[model samples]
Target: MKKQLLLLVLLFLGSIALLQSQVTGTVTDEDGTPLPGASVVKKGTRVGTTTDFDGKFSIDAIIGDRLTISYIGYQPKEVLINSTIMSITLVSGVQLAEVVITGSRNPNRTATESTVPIDVIDVKQLANAAPQVNLNQILNYVAPSFTSNTQTISDGTDHIDPASLRGLGPDQVLVLINGKRRHTSSLINVNGTFGRGSVGTDLNAIPTAAIQRIEVLRDGAAAQYGSDAIAGVINIILNKNVDELLINVT
Candidate 1:
């Protein structure tokens, strides 16, 4: 009878211990404000949860469970949970140096060929750059060599700034989006139908949000991108693996 009573006592203690093993913590930004909807995930695993409105979250785990916290516009953080902490702070994200596309026509060109002088901009930079509705706004401060000249015609319609590729005229340069040719908007307003309003990728139509990176030859390129590539070549790479939900409004 004593043995039976001892066994029951042990089983009850085991149940209580199991219930106490869950891990929990609160997540906040650098400013100490609660970050609702921030994702907390296990390192290298799909198991994860989002913080509640109160910035609180809980998950079942054992000792040494690695956790990763991530949110938009913030640097992702990782923590190893050996003990319980009431709150975790996440830092703001900064742009790290990235491999920019360069010198494709001559595959032999070394990585340091900034001599060609291409201005490559990433989509994420657009948020901080705060560009206007048209591509002209984004390019205005990008390159000193290129100038954007917009003039209003007799009608209320505003004229687009001609993309001057080293003053070589728009027809000489080739504009490609993801290697595909985009139709010209109207005639190259500068050169007439033959040149057609400097027809190239309507940088506006491609949506800067969808761009991953841009590669500009900055030098003459007739062999690789083809005949129209006299002035220079501007190639826009689209983001294939990006989530559609990452849209931002200026």
Candidate 2:
């Protein structure tokens, strides 16, 4: 009688183990688009697996086990494991506005840490609203303490308006393209409009469409970058992206 009782107990334990089977499922959005990297977890336990590139996931579970699926920007779902194959669709209920940031992230920076102020202008965003495609005119409207005045009567400064900063002459404000010093293409001459006619770069030479962004160091950069930056520094970063090509008409 003792041997028969032990045999019955072993057979009962084996039957319980055989009840559990493998469960597979595919996770998709409401529109049937596969949601790759979605989270899939078995309820009441830590066993879980993320959806593959094809949104397919597999796990070992019994017929009554529960599964929870979750994804970012979508409502989570829960379902009972009734079959070996399952199809889960996450609802599009949760949505938040996108925060667009152009500048680099600096968490611990304080306002008093640096004396010089820098103005960051996103040229790509300005391209749509600007009246003309002139880079010089766009800077005058967006950046503070900077101006590009067109001299209707001046000699060489006629077509190419000079750029100035902090009420200083164009020569006093150093211009840099991609961190390298950009020398003045020609002299202002006659001590006219923007300084003693020694050095001045042509702002009109750089195409506005090719520029990505501009960083203007407000004032007092001469101590670090020499007399060229006595008023400030204007760094023009051109677009080095390999995605698009630009064509001009006349």
Candidate 3:
């Protein structure tokens, strides 16, 4: 009886060893280039491995088990492990084109190619986070270096608040609307305010409803633009792709 029990135990161990098998695979892109660092994971389990420098990976898996292969910028692929070796070709994901014009002279230049730091705020972001309808107030909260203060009764300056960038005077910062030079407000801040003795642009003059996106170039562009861009340049791009006339009361 003891010998019979030993034989049954050996058969069970052999069956278990046969159930678990080693799986090897090579991951490649659509162009047939080896994609190193690709992840290969068994479905619904923690068993996984990554491709080596040659885009080859090996992991323990059973037959009929599913394997998921994934890589950055590529579409994920899944296959059933019918064999020990697998050759996977991952397709590329769809990429969207971006438009950037703040720091680059070329209109077709992307934001990643710009040497200067740039911040782009869309209309939705501006209006969603703004507590007040004033553009200066919205920029003060959104922009890093922009600042503005409300004047109670400081002549015409109360109506037209002055805004500064990078802790510099208001006149030091240049403002552009739709790529055109926007004129500064006639009211100069002569009172004791944040930007005293500086005439700044009346950003409130342009309704936030009309704006599409605001691009702020944080680097000095005196050589490219002019001396007016000593502090930085704030370019307000208007929406030209409006198919329907939408108006916001507030």
Candidate 4:
């Protein structure tokens, strides 16, 4: 009787092991594109796995278990494990505002640490916000203090638009590329504009693709960089980490 009772207990334990199931799924975007690097985790548990290159994933779970899926730039999802296979779809999330860098010759300073108000725009954010290929137009919309308008028929000035900061002349706003002084445009704005006699830098001369990020110092820096930076200063940092070729048709 003792041996028979021990055998019954072993069988019950074996049945519990067989009841546990393996769950498999594929994570995709709303458009059905496979989203690699998406995370899958068991709800209220530490067990998790990231989707493979093909957006496929597998995890050990049982029936009635809840799985949570998430990815960057996409909405998270939760589903009950009713079936062994699941096809999870995630929607795109709203784009967050880019953070700005402030108050330091060193580019590594955070926004909280600096006392001066500064605006920083990354290349990705600029490309998305820019309506046209012109760099001046991008800054006009992104920077609150900067302003520019496309000229219709003003000879050579029409090609190069004048830009100003804090309602001041464009020349008063110093331009810097990679922390160095950028040359001013030869075409001075002799027309009736905010920057009438000032020869400002041709902001559109530099392609948006080549830039890594732009830091605009909203405060006056005459004591730091001389009279040219009376209104403010703009520092355009070039892209140094180029790993892949980017082709822009428009």
Rank the candidate models, highest TM-score first: 4, 3, 2, 1
| Candidate rank order under lDDT | 4, 3, 2, 1
TM-score of 3: 0.53
Give a tens-digit lDDT track for model 4, residues 178-224. 99999998987775755887898889999888888888887888999
Query: Which stretches of model 2 miss by more than 4 angstroms?
Result: 1-115, 247-250
Relative to the true structure, how large is the alpha-carbon lDDT of every model? 0.68, 0.81, 0.84, 0.84
TM-score of each: 0.46, 0.52, 0.53, 0.53
Query: What is the lDDT for 197 in model 4?
Result: 79
The worst-scoring run of ten residues by lDDT in candidate 1 lies at: 103-112
Model 1 Cα lDDT, one tens digit per residue, 1-250: 9999999999999977765577789999888998999999978788889999989999766557889998887899889988655478989875668868753333332235565555575646665766554555565555444445555552211444456567676666677878876555563464332233445434555666667766666778787677677788777888888655875665
Residues 1-250, candidate 3: write the lDDT tens digits.
Answer: 9999999999999888868879898999988999999999999999999999999999999888999999988888899988888899999975659756663333432255568767787766757667768788878877777887878778777788888788888888899998899998887787687677878888889888778888888678889888888888999998786777877766
What's the CA RMSD for each of the models? 19.7, 14.5, 13.5, 16.7
Q: What is the lDDT of residue 84 in candidate 1?
A: 53
Q: What is the lDDT of residue 196 in candidate 1?
A: 37
Name the regions of candidate 1 deviating beyond 4 angstroms. Answer: 1-118, 130-133, 154-160, 190-201
Candidate 2: how many backbone clashes?
A: 0
TM-score: model 1 vs. ground truth: 0.46
Local lDDT at 60 for model 1? 68
Measured on C-alpha atoms, candidate 3 has an lDDT of: 0.84
- Pitting candidate 2 against candidate 3, the one with the higher TM-score is 3
Give the Cα-based TM-score of candidate 4 against the true structure. Answer: 0.53
